[model samples]
Target chain A: MSGFLTLLKRDLLLALREGGALGTALGFYLIVVTLMPLGLGPDLNLLTRIAPGILWVALLLAALLSLPRLFEADHDDGSLDVLALGHMPLELVAASKALAHWISTGIPLALMAPILGILLNLEARAYPLVIATMLAGTPAISFLGAIGAALTLKTRRGGLLLALLVLPFYVPTLIFGITSISAALLSPAGFQASFLILTAISLVSLVLGPVAAAAALRQHMQ
Target chain B: MTTDAATQTWTQRLANPTRFMALSGQILPWLTIAAIAVVLYGLYLTFFVAPPDYQQGETVKIMFIHVPSAWLAMMGYLMIAISSFGLLVFRHPLADVSAKSAAPIGAAFTLLALITGSLWGKPMWGTYWVWDARLTSVLILFFLYLGLMALRSSLEDETLAAKQTAVLGLAGVVILPIIKFSVDWWNTLHQPASVVKIDGPAIHSSILVPLVVNAVGFSLLFFALHMKAMRNEVLRRRVKALRMAEVEQAARGRDTSSATAG
Candidate 1:
């Protein structure tokens, strides 16, 4: 457990020190949200109706932009090899890195979402729901993204390939996140069910992601 | 001890790629003949014997192809998942070949399903597409297949690629059900409240017979294609190995000549 925490702290420190990745992701999120109204014409009613979807989709893409770096940096610097040889299990290493990714990248993306919501004319009441659903859903994104990052660790130009591989798995998370927010905006009754399911998806990915990422990393190490 | 010995020999024979090549060689012609014969018979039945639906008329005929393709699409993924398990857990040499060969075929069938489905939808649903739950799920399945193929092709290392692809395939299998469930939930919420549900017509004996025949025939065809693909992959690996050996021998010759000069 201490080993996991150390690795997590190390990763968090690296992300903060580097700082550019998180900034680029947030800027990308802002750009994508800004482009939507221009593309569709500035119809406030339409923007309000589709705000949850735009926010969630753009957030997924933003999270995806940083995914290829999840393991590439460690692997390239040879720290991954030392970590692989450590007392800690590779699965735990993967989990810590993914958890760190969620903290450093996912949380910031989720928090930035509500602010971007203003640009899309997102309903005032929906802001809290959007923030809540995104906070719950982004862990699944980071965790699942770890699997893609690990699998593509040795590939050339892996960013596009990682997107293709990881985005399909994001379907359930995206569906639940957007639907839960919409349900809350439209009525109170359906929101709880969708939100709970979204959280369950995050938990399931939290477990499955690390194991699968470890398996892929092991193959690459071999 | 005798039974154990017998089982060992059986598995050894099955596991030997050379023996597999010979065995599949013998089976291929017969499988091909059977698949072609059955498919022709099925198509005849579909066209000549079955009556058009009362409601859909000619458009109903599309179901004969569309449904079977969809079934193969799912079955193809199942085959890849099982083969991946065999490769990863049992270290079966042929399992990777099976998994690799199954992907393109599965993807092709998935594409067929989508195309036929939309063609049917245009005449029936008055549009070429809708975000219907089943269609959406299959579309995602198609994307999964593409991802598997893309991941495998991107890596230059064959052995590592095989293992990585297997890991992804298994993850896909685990996630498929959740994706289906979520899509269904999303569809229900967004589906227009008053849209009349169009339940499928009851399967009459006439329609049922042709459908079953086509399904069986198509399944047979899928296996034949898979077997043939496995053969090609085996041969390709053999060629690669031979080329690698030749290069190694050439490099050794150069090293020996240089050593002698030194």
Candidate 2:
């Protein structure tokens, strides 16, 4: 556990210090979100209606933008081999990296979503729901993304392949994330059902992602 | 030992690639005959024998094609999943080819399903497309097939590519049920006029018989195509090996001559 935490801290430190992954993803998110109105015109009612979908999809893409760096750099530099042999297991290393990605990219993206929400004319009432759903949902993106990152770890310039492999898996999260926020406008009960389903998706992926990624890493990491 | 002997015999005998190649070569002709016979007969039955719908009229004929292709679309993915499982868990030699063969076949069937479904829809539902759950889910399934093919093609290492794609292929199996559930919920929310439910008892016996026949025919067709593709893949790998050996030989020849000259 301590070893896992240490790996997580080291990755988080690296992400913060290099300042590229997190900053670029957040900037991309801002730009993508900011352009929604410019593309669709200044229809506040329309923007607010589509806000959850726009926010969730843009957030997913931004999260995806940083996914390639998660395993590629370590694998290229031979650090992953060392980490694989470290106190923690390969699966734990995978989990820790995914967690670090979430902490660095996911959290920042989720936090920045509401700020972008204003630009999209998101409802003031749905603010907490948007943030809450994002927080619950973002881990699944990072964790599942680790599997893609691992599978393509050996291929040069594998970003497109990673996106292809990862985005289909994002369907459930995107559906439920948008659903829960939209449901909040209907009833508390409806919102709870969808929100819980979204959380279940994240937690399920959090477990499956690392194990699958570790399996791929073991297979492909030469 | 005798009780287990028979089971092991089939497994051990076919497990060898050479053995599989010989057996499949012998069986391919018969499989082709069966596929052609069944599909031609099925199509005949579909057009002539299956009674026109009292409601949908002749437009219901599209269901014969659409329904079977949809079944194959789902079944193709399942075939890939099963092959992938074999590759991962049992390390079967032919599993990668089996998985590889299924992707394009599955994508073609999925495209057929969407197109036929649309044609049937235009007449019945008065619109060619709607965001209903089944259509949306099937569209996603098509993308999944494309993604699998893309992943397989991008990697250079034959063994590693096979294993990695097998892993992704297995993960996609989860989407099947989610598509079912989400689409059901989505259609319920929208409550549009459904064309033919496509599932329940509303399908008449005349239509049902041809539908079943076409489904069996399509399965045979998929088998024949899959086997032929796998055989071609084996031959392709052999050609690749020969070329690689030639390249290495040339490189070694240059190295030795340079050494002798020095």
Candidate 3:
């Protein structure tokens, strides 16, 4: 519906005006990738072998850093209360917010992943696979984080708790994302399975996540 | 509608806190006895009765413990999700107790699975730990259990703790499918499922019969322990209330005594 799109646009515009919200995530991703080679030593072979994991992990953490702000701003300013009372179903509202989150955080991370992939000396063949996996996997991050953000909306010390609740859910996406690239680099025949699985996970999350988030929000407001 | 009288009475009886407590208290010893007996028999069958694996030899014995423990870990999370749904939908007090009790039991099962897995891995895989799909996902489940328990403890309000934990419980469901499908998704060295397949359990009955028995035993063990733990939680709540009441009484007495002396 138009309402959902409008809500998504509003969220995106808000993130744009905030200035450093998007920058901070990318900066964290860049720094984590830059630091890995220094700590792991400058062996190109070693870097290449491990680059997929490092890239995937950095993307995951960067995606996670943007999660707490998803609902905190709206909740703090009382916009969330207004939104809750609006005409749209809460699940639709949650879906819109999650889409906005993916656009602001997940897209930027996906765009920057390739540059970091190069820094870690990833194989040229693996670049497309890395991008593809990040594209497929990051939406799930936003969708799932909505539940965490909703649960901790008014709780004290929510940031630490948010990380605790969300990270375990992140493991599968992390594994699949990294494995896609690894499979691509190691054996071309198997990479397709990983990609398909990642896609399947994202599709399932996309459908189920908004409903779960709406449930959490309903519980919170009560 | 009056509905089924017998079934309604059973639910009503369990819903009554005091009656449930007394009933569970009476049944606890018997369930505990059954659990212990079954587990011991399972262990005996695991070691002496089951034939050694042709390829794996003695190391396969580890599967008896590891497989059951792992199965229970997954089942525990499902229980959490179910109890959580009950809390949110039905507003049942017992559901909250069930969810809280499940966390520690789940954590214990997770640890048992990990340890037995490592013991098996040492001989089979030549290493105890790998970032493989099956191992990693299960480890994440263990951490999820830890996080749930931590979240429960961090909140001061009982209602808030219960609500927040239910949310976490529901959110954790996302991992189940991933855990189930990770082997098919990735090129991990871990072997694929041997039981609960579309074609039925892949392993022969010789190995699987004891495995099922132990699995049932472990499940019953979880239920019995969980019921006892929930009872403890209720008692703990009561004791806290009683202590707070006594403190208030003492404070009032002190104030009255001071006023009279003045």
* CAPRI classification of candidate 2: medium
As a whole number from 0 to 100, the lDDT of residue B136 in candidate 2 is 74
Q: Please report, in order, the local distance difference test score of every candidate based on alpha carbons.
A: 0.90, 0.87, 0.86
Q: Give model 1's docking category.
A: high
Model 3 lDDT tens row, A1-222:
998989999999999998688999999999989999999999999998888889888888888888888888888888888889999999998999999999999988998888888788888887888888999999999998887777767667878888888888777677678777777777889799878888887887887778878887876676
Residue-pair clashes per candidate, as listed? 0, 0, 0
- Per-residue lDDT value at B164 in model 3: 81
lDDT of 2 by residue, B1-262 (tens): 5676566867456667777789899999999999999999999998778888898899988988988898789889999999999899988888888899889999999999999999998988889998776787788899889888887788888899899899888878887776556645664432332333656556567778888888889999999999999889888988898999999999999999999999
| Better structure of 1 and 3 per TM-score | 1
Question: DockQ for each candidate?
Answer: 0.90, 0.64, 0.47
Please identify which of the two predictions, 1 or 2, would achieve the higher DockQ against the true structure. Answer: 1
Model 3 Cα lDDT, one tens digit per residue, B1-262: 2465455757555767887899999999999999988988888889889999999998988999999899889889999999998898888878888899999999999999999999898889999998788888889999899888877877777887898889789778767776778788666878888888988999988899888889878988998999899999889988999999999999999999999999
What TM value does chain B of candidate 2 have?
A: 0.88
The best candidate in terms of lDDT? 1
- The TM-score obtained for chain B by all candidates, in the order given, is 0.89, 0.88, 0.91
The sequence of per-residue lDDT tens digits that candidate 1 reaches over residues B1-262 is 5686577865456678998999999999999999999999999999999899999897777888887887799889999999999898988899999999999999999999999989998888888888766677788899999999999999999999999999999999964564335444554422221111256445777888888899889999999999999999999999999999999999999999999999
